[model samples]
Target: MTGDLGNLRYISPWYGGGMPPDPSLPNRRDARRNRDLFIEHAKATFAEHGVDASLERIAREAGLAIGTLYRHFPTRVDLLLAVFEPKLRDFLATAEAALKMADPWEGFLVFLEALCGAQAYDRGFNDFIARRFPRDERTEVMHDRVCQLARSILSRAQAAGVVRPDIAEADLIALLWANSRIAEATRQVAPGVWRRHMHLVIDGFRAGDRHELPEPSLSPEQLYRVMARLGE
Candidate 1:
């Protein structure tokens, strides 16, 4: 896992790569204020409505025109990247630390706990992690890196004789989807309930004398297509 961790460096493009200068900067002070207002409202709106939240609604909440919103963020993905960049950094940091843990199974558990905790706390992040946006090159790169990390971790656990060899990366993706749903449903009535369920699922995945599953795991291409469809 330590050797594999070195190959998994994922500096987010939003932070490292040069993005275009803020278009609102050249305009009057009011334009800069409007841009700030839009981002503030957008954070709340996306928190409530997920990533597909309406740009027009965000503008309205900001008391700015839709055209102004467009001037600040030409595309939904642009706004999304801005809104999620901080959260993404935090998540990636946690994941990276988990990958460096000495015990493969312990590392896997830490990763899942952090991932699921993020999903449970933020509806927008839950949606963000579950789907694939192929047209957005930066987002696609991030998603692919995340998937690769999951595969590496899973394989490490399997090789360590902790996790079941039959489990695949697709299975972990499926578990993420399941965890998202469970978190959403129980968030209001029982906010911490998902942890119990997750632990039970983890117990099931542990290597032991267990019943053989009849179905095959999804192929890598098949998993990619399925996640893309979910985005659509």
Candidate 2:
């Protein structure tokens, strides 16, 4: 990964490097070129505007015609949905890549950090997405993907005798969601307190099912609602 872009995850020579040429991007690269360009800018636009960002703004930023944007996305929701797919793919890819860490616990911690980062940043967007399209198939698929990946990691740690045998996938996801809450609450009080709580939680998780636990983590929907109220 480092060899490709030297730890700059967002730099894609194919998608994000720089514009190809004027109007000639096609007859050159693969399909979805314009769509990829739209996704790149849309993410930035959405970050600033939440779900209210205009398709016109996205197309202007991407230097594409509005018709071209609609040709690919068809609807604003389609564009949002498309941009979200690869964003999450990047998220899960990072977690899976962390499995290469020499220490199981360290890898697990990094995975938790990845989750925390997403919650800190994308949780709002995620909630907006949920409200926009409750039970979206893509979101459901992502939920299952995350759940399965966490379960696999838990199994790995348990097999290594470092994690509790009874630790379910739900437990880790809850922990990540909880840590995000702390991060949101104490962001002004101190930076990285959520990271601190994450380490503490990890210690408890490693201690396994024998230990008393904090409150169960909020469901994804509940977390979204809580964060929305926090924003309000």
Candidate 3:
């Protein structure tokens, strides 16, 4: 229970969800039975697979037409998002809650860990729109919300004398992106790099802005594309 939402093992209703599925969605009266069938089977199938899981299998299990699946989910990621349902809302909620913690260090820990987990799940955090999907309105909204939460947490942490007073929210977001990338690259050969770097980062932030130097945050997508082209 690291508070990770991606792990379906902890999704309660999903765990108890029966073989047919939950009959809560709005299909026409004529399609109710089959829609419920699809929902139930899709839930189990996606749980077994992931965002890119087999739609054909889901349709087969749901006993619905493949067209029905596409009608319900215009894209795979949308279906993925629906799996977690409140994944974004949960993220925003977590950030907001971190702001109210009593200790600056602990509050910062909560914030850092949340961003870290987001990165761990995908190579991008605050970056859902960069994929094949159209611009995610939720990304912009979540960005602003999380940015405010980060600012509030940092301001409080600085006031408590645990963080550097001059560091801004943009700085934190950039650090999050950088750190997440680091974790992804190193998790295989350099395990625990994420936590180790977090300690190093917080140490720098706590050093009264006197650290020798630090990585300047850049656009991860741009960096990724540039690196991808080097091989071609």
Candidate 4:
């Protein structure tokens, strides 16, 4: 991973070379500080404005030039990877932990709560999870892993007769897209309001009272194309 990221040229003279500094080296303290500041500001900026937040605004917030931001994160996706890596790990961990639970129904609910709760807090992360960056191998891998994990969890619940068998990964993705909009609209006025809507959605997913949908779920290939279009 480091080798792949090293291809990005470090343009800041503060690092004394046109190469990215190793944050672990003692001599690169200032460079590390600047990078940290950029990440900190970028997190807050992205949260407020979504992943498409202005890079110039993030640089301004970090008290650095836009070039400095670019020097550290050569592309918007690179900066997004830095900002979202931890949260992504957390979400994956939550899914893993939920999968380990004895009851599939309980595990499914826990997974949804963790996923939706994370989305409710950060709009940028929400966008990141919703779209597919087909050109970025790293993000593509992450997206594929997340989709597989979600499918596994949903399948487990259905096998246990808790979730409707008709429910698909595409349906879950649609829920995420819907939750993102709900979270954005009521972020200030009522942050916790999403919980009500999420619970209602969950109720609809139950096998006992499932209703026939008007349209068919998107196939895996169709879902991929839709997500890719979202990124574009």
Candidate 5:
């Protein structure tokens, strides 16, 4: 009902905004079973090794042939999309809720906390959020949606004179990149250290008595190039 990927569906009865599964795929029960197995194993492997995890090993662990994996995913992005779909939907919902909060400053904090918390555990998701997949329309659209929501939350706070007016979406993205590295370095040694850093960063975002930043925010094209480089 929604292009070749069926209708857009709820992630569950409680949460919504999940992506549709491909309708072009086989409907046979065995085919569905294999797809489920591949997804389950892939989620774990990606969590451990990021999106570039060995496909061969994932296939072997799923108890399916490599060909079966190729048949379903076709590319690493496809697998990444499948693996992260639910989490992505959850994040979008959180952002939407943040946008609706009465206190713009509180909403800004809520949104940033959700964004950073997502990267604290899964390495694959950490990489996923930081990089840009320019060649894939699906991922591109997903990124666009994220930026849209972020900008809305940011502008709302700026309008309320809570967050600094100079703050941009690119600055928020920079925070995520910083959090990713901090998370990797300190996750084992100090699991909650990233939050401490995030609070400091959040303090810097407050409007009053803030000194001007020395440089302007990154241009959209520059930001795109940076994210593209991360993927490479």
Candidate 6:
């Protein structure tokens, strides 16, 4: 997988030229340095103010013109993909390794820890995982890959009779939504508390001696709409 905008996996129309050149173009030493600065500043800014952070502020902080920022990253999502590319690779790798574990329950726990731990650190990434950007094919691909991995991880656990039979992919997403709120509220007051909260929820997921849930889990359409609205 592509690591960052410097080496973007999928080149969109916004890149000006077709593939091969890479998204961080212009090739000049100063130009490349400017691009790197934008990405570095953006990484910190987005982590602090989230994906909705100000682009103008990022440019100002980087001592670059706003037009320069736009020239390098035409859109907010473009900047985001660049900033979080490495983290995304780590996440995907974690999920893949989880799937390969011999114990399904252990794999499930490992995946959950990686997933929630990611959200607990970066607010932008928290928003990234929680929302759905339907317009961008790149974000769509990222989301689709995540959903596919999640389903495989969950299904593996369920099939092994380690997870509750009633659990669905939607439930895992619901946990993420809940974790996002918990992380936001308690990040400063008590960092790492989300882990405790996750473990509490995870206990309920285990098979055996379970009471019925009060409501049915969301359908695929409903979940999609919920995530899409979050993007809006």
For TM-score, candidate 1 versus 2, the one ahead is: 1
List the lowest-lDDT window of 10 residues for candidate 6: 1-10
Runs of candidate 6 with Cα error greater than 4 angstroms are: 1-27
Q: Which candidate leads in lDDT?
A: 4
Expressed as tens digits, the lDDT of each residue in 1-232 for candidate 4 is 6654444334453533465556679747778999999999989988888988999999998999999889899999999999999999999999999988999999999998888889898999998999999999999999988998899999999999999988999998888889888988998999999989999998999998656999999999999999999898
> How big is the positional error of residue 39 in model 3, measured in Å on the Cα after superposition?
9.5
Q: Alpha carbon lDDT of residue 225, candidate 2?
A: 59
Report the alpha-carbon TM-score of model 4 versus the true structure. Answer: 0.87
Candidate 1 lDDT over 169-209, as tens digits, reads 88888888888789888988999999998888888889989
- Clash counts per candidate, in order, are 0, 0, 1, 0, 0, 0
What are the per-residue Cα lDDT tens digits for candidate 3 across 145-220? 6656777888889888888766766567557657756876786797577788876776778835475546544454
Q: Model 3: residues >4 Å from true position, as ranges?
A: 1-67, 75-77, 121-136, 189-191, 207-232
Backbone collision tally, model 5: 0
lDDT of 5 by residue, 1-232 (tens): 4543333244332225665565666667778899899999999998878888899999999999999999999998999999997999999999999999999999999999999999778889988988999988998898889989999999999999989989988999999988878988898899899999998999999999989899999987899999988887
lDDT (Cα) of model 4: 0.90
* Per-residue lDDT of 86 in model 3: 59
For model 1 the local lDDT of residue 52 reads: 85
Per-residue CA lDDT of model 2 for 1-232, tens digit only, reads 6565643434543555643445756544644677789888988887656656788989999998999888888866677677666666877897887676777777777777777766565543544423324335655566566756776667777788888765666567567557656866786688567777887877877744575555654565675455445333
lDDT score at residue 202, model 4, on the 0-100 scale: 87
Local lDDT at 39 for model 6: 94
lDDT of 1: 0.84
Give per-residue lDDT, candidate 4, residue 110. Answer: 92
Error of 3 at 38 (Å): 9.5
TM-score of structure candidate 5: 0.85
Each prediction's whole-model lDDT (CA): 0.84, 0.67, 0.62, 0.90, 0.89, 0.89
Clashing pairs in 1: none
Which candidate would rank higher by TM-score, 3 or 4?
4
RMSD of each: 12.6, 11.7, 13.0, 9.1, 10.7, 10.2
| Candidate 2 minimal-lDDT segment of 10 residues | 126-135
